[model samples]
Target: MNKPWSESWFDAYAPERFEAFTPSHVWAVLGLIVCALLLWLTRGVIRSHKSVSEGIRWFLMAVLFLSEVTLNIWYVTQRIWDAQTSLPLELCSVTLLLSILMLFFRSRWLYPIILFAGIGGALQAVLTPNLAYAFPHYRFIHFFVAHSGIILAALYMTWIEGLKPTWKSVGGAMLFLNGLALIVWIVDTALGANYMFLAGKPSTPSILDVLGAYPAYILAEEVIALLFFSLMMLLFEVLPGGRLYARSGTYKKTY
Candidate 1:
């Protein structure tokens, strides 16, 4: 009664309906913690080795770009490539694109937006993933790689490259996110797609569940996002040498 690997891989639309915060979830959380620790530990090496650092950045960018393309291809192969759902309109999807751009071009204007969105959006996605798939599934792998890549990129820029965010940068990120949300709302209305969950909350339990009902929850999310952004800023203040690194102008030319 053994199923083919592909059958097992794509089967059940998710993993046996596992509950949240299960063993797999615990492992996923541990993985993120390990990643953060590794990144912090390697910050010195990344800063000291310029060419190597750039190579690592480029490699991460390529991984992100290719992972996204592969996801689209998988959807097509599965015959599930719906225009409404497959488009890169989700906040994390948009974050991936911006993360790539930030890596390639090192745009100063995008620093805070990527920082805020990457941690705010991608970190949350990793923690409370909307994914149904579990380990060894392509969907599960792709979901983690894509979201984790955003966080890594943001950290690389801040810790290694020394791009710092100001209070004004926080405002900029809020404005950019809300403005993009407005456009997505229009698109969601037109196509009846729930990109960004603007149409409604997801069927699965999520942070949205505790936020409140539909439209009201959307507003609450905005407030929550702002709070998260402020907290990320505070993180820099508390980290050892973070403020000094931010004040340093060594990498200003790149930005």
Candidate 2:
């Protein structure tokens, strides 16, 4: 029997569950990385052509926005909309919303937060996704596409818009994350929800599995986040090659 259109599109319990390190997962990861590399490689061309750059930015914004909206619609359609888990309180979800704003406004203030926390959070979600559905499922495609869009938003601002993030931006991002986590914690307590995995580690096998148990892993995550954000600064801002690019005056400062 053929499933109804709604069931075909929004079924929450798809037969194939996402398995990390599977061929499909690996290909998706590599594909996103290639896109990022292509953007960097063609930065000059993109900068020279304003219309093309704007179009790409708008495209990313649309993808990110639609992915998020459709995921919520799926949740509601599947009758799985719980206040605890259905809300957009997860790290990547929050970053996805911010990424949209970052692209639209080209706000320098939002750049560092997205550059550090947005990329870091989204990258973790990409590597060890906590998803229920596998390839070709709406949730699976939505999960990866939304996370990838968050990553590309940061890259677009940096490689295309030339918005530079300073070392202090690392601390800024950490502080912002901590503040957001605090708010999420309060919400989790009130709703008995585990948004951001604050109540406990995720059910899936993730980096948190090796970190430690319960509250201890939360502390460990802070250290891990710091290290990752610092590495981003080194790679994107402090590297000698990137310094040369900055000195060349190819990047027009907009904000």
Error of 2 at 182 (Å): 0.4
Misplaced by over 4 Å in model 1 are: 10-18, 240-255
What tens-digit string does per-residue lDDT give for candidate 2 at 174-201? 9999999999999999999999999898
Per-model TM-score on C-alpha atoms: 0.90, 0.92
What TM-score, to 2 decimals, does candidate 1 have? 0.90
Where's the lowest-lDDT run of ten residues in candidate 1?
246-255
- Cα error of candidate 1 at position 57, Å: 0.2
Output candidate 1 Cα RMSD. Answer: 2.7
Model 1 Cα shift for residue 242 (angstroms): 4.9
